[model samples]
Target: MGSVTVYGPPISTAVSRVLACLLEKDVDFKLVNVDMAKGQHKSPDYLKLQVLSLPSPLLLHHRTPTPSLLVLMSLILTAYADRGNKNLLGRNGGGPAERAQVEQWLEAESQSFNPPSSALVFQLAFAPRMGLPQDPAAVELNQAKLAKVLDVYERRLGESRFLARDEFSLADLAHLPNAHYICSAGKDDMLASRKNVARWWEEISTRPSWKKVVDMYSAPPA
Candidate 1:
């Protein structure tokens, strides 16, 4: 039981990640809705509470903007990366090592997979809702980038079956929402073409925890 304040618009992959973690741990937290649709996330109230200062990477470089998804991710790990039995992250201080590996693969997922693919889906789906037209060139670029990431995932998953070793960890949890979002945006059949990644996804997606996070709350399409 933690007084966690999750500040972000619902339906984002990041929010999904945190929600899945809370469900898995059977922990309760308050959800603050910063409707990105109405520009609430960028408003001063939300920004002061959730995005007050720069994160660890470049403390002085204020020019670099922090993504809300990344911020929520950090919050999730900080809260649930510990605790017993529900310690899905790892065991003991070993959880630390595993947690670091989780960070590694999650970074890979975000850098190599999430950005371009998400950009494409956002442009096709959310942008239009936000009064922007679909840009075909961006769509193509996103598809190409996703293809390369899938190729890498296909190989990596062929070995371990999950991002961490045999057991489930926050690493796998972190990517689930992104995977769901990407697949739901009509990339399921496309990304599923990768044998190992597809197999891996099959295993993780079935977890009861993920369903609560994924299907329970999705932002309605505008």
Candidate 2:
């Protein structure tokens, strides 16, 4: 098998998500930095791999490029689960029911959690860094939206240690990157204010695999 190469900087939420997944699955891969600031993502070469201009990570393996972030992570998780890394999918070898539950939470994260969270991350964190003006209305709207989502998560997490069940799965992993930025945006209260949600966040965000991803973000460029 050829080496797996991920194109995008670690700061990108989608890229970090894939990086953390690869770490959790114990997969070795190379990182090829894409400076979105420099419009590198718009380069002809980068666009060739991701024509959709999706702000997601691009994965190159065996000369094949996977452009969709969800597809890339799904492929990694399913491939590893089939190889005995069952926890990536769900608890107890991820039976059909458990797998279904995992997919449910994954959908919730994508549909419910991601929209508001990503908007807030962009408005509060990225805007300031990129010299773009933050939109106050957007921030307020997304804050309310994310809070509502977290309230539901607090209730669900009270019953289950993870989104799907008592075991950590891709469902929880899927939220790590966005939630990390939400906290970084100085809106940690959205997560920290809810007890069960806070506890869940602590557990998942502190996982050694995720910590490694954070370290990668801070690592000096080669």
Candidate 3:
């Protein structure tokens, strides 16, 4: 198979999530940076490839953009399971029940964790970087929402080492990018304050795949 190409800036949570998945699967891939700041993502040529044209990270294997983040990650798992990350979707060494549980947590991350975490990351981390004013009301509101979600996570983690019952599946992987930024936003207490959640976060965040993505973000531009 040709090397898969992922197009988007590393700093984008969606892009970084894909990158980390590729890494975990041990899939060989290339990253083509999209400069959102220069309006390149909205360019006519880009829109042809990605109709949504928003946080658009096109996976080149399909020769078209997979607009949904979940779809893109599912595609990666389908294409690269032999590369040895099938358990991410609970395909290897995991039964149907376990697979269902993995999906459950993936949904939880999308519906529960993502909303407030994304808001907090943007309001606290991205806004200042773009010279946009921080809305205290937004921050306060998201913080409360996120705290409630983390509370659920805290209890869940107590029962399992990772979100989907002791395995670090896509369930946990999905949260890395935004959680990283939330930590940078000085709101890591949201995770750190919860004992079980803190332990789970440390294990997943320190994985080699995610560490590589974080290093790419920290590295000086080429």
Candidate 4:
């Protein structure tokens, strides 16, 4: 099998999501850190490997680069079918209904969950850690937005153990990195308050794959 390479900082939630998927798929891969503070991701070499117009955390397999998380997960699944882990996407993830549902929730994570969670992480955690000023208004706004999104998730999760279904899928995995950050930012109440949402978070966030990713990025004990 061709080797996999992931390019992005470990602290990046998107990058962490990709890493978690790769780990869950049991794909051997190398991680190349991109220094966003130094604008390394904007370098000419990095831009060529990435779609440039889309997003960061490019996945490269045998020199072919793809920016789609779905594509990245599919590639790993295809390469390792003998590993017998077919449920990540679902039974025949390519099937019309399953594919659509998975894609829909994936979109929700990207559009709905990520934005506000990112805002909260930046304002509440990243800024203070970087000695930058946190914006109270931005923090409040994102907190409210995240609360609303979680409310929807609580309802949806109450219907199903996982976002795409009772089985764990990429849809639920996608939320891990950001949701972990939200909790780390001392906003666990957002999740703890919602029984179903908290249950869902606990289930996915404790996966061995995510635990490895967390250890990889965790700060050293003081």
Against the reference, the lDDT scores of all candidates come to 0.65, 0.87, 0.86, 0.83
The number of the candidate with the highest lDDT is 2
Which parts of model 2 have CA positions greater than 4 angstroms off? 82-85
Residues 25-89, model 2: lDDT tens digits: 77889999888889998999889986477878999877787889888988777656554346867
lDDT of 3 by residue, 1-222 (tens): 667888788898998999999999998887877778797787787778875656647887846667777788888887776886667966484688998999899889989999998998899888987899999999999899999999999998899899998778998999999999999878888889999999999999999999999998866543
**Residues 121-221, model 4: lDDT tens digits:** 88876788678998989989999998999999999999999998878888888888878888988889999999999898889888999999998786432
Models ranked on lDDT: 2, 3, 4, 1
- Lowest lDDT 10-residue stretch of candidate 1: 54-63
TM-score of each model, paired residue for residue: 0.77, 0.94, 0.94, 0.89
lDDT of 1 by residue, 1-222 (tens): 335555554476666676776677666655666566687666675555433432211111122334455555454455555642344555553556776776788688767876876786687657776898888898888888888888988888878868776667777776776677667767687567888888888988999888766565664432
Query: How close to the true structure is residue 138 of candidate 3, measured as C-alpha lDDT?
Result: 94
Task: Give residue 122's lDDT in candidate 3 (0 to 100).
Answer: 92
| TM value for model 3 | 0.94
* Candidate 3, residue 79: how far the Cα is off, in Å: 0.9
lDDT of 3 at 109: 90
Clashes of 3: 0
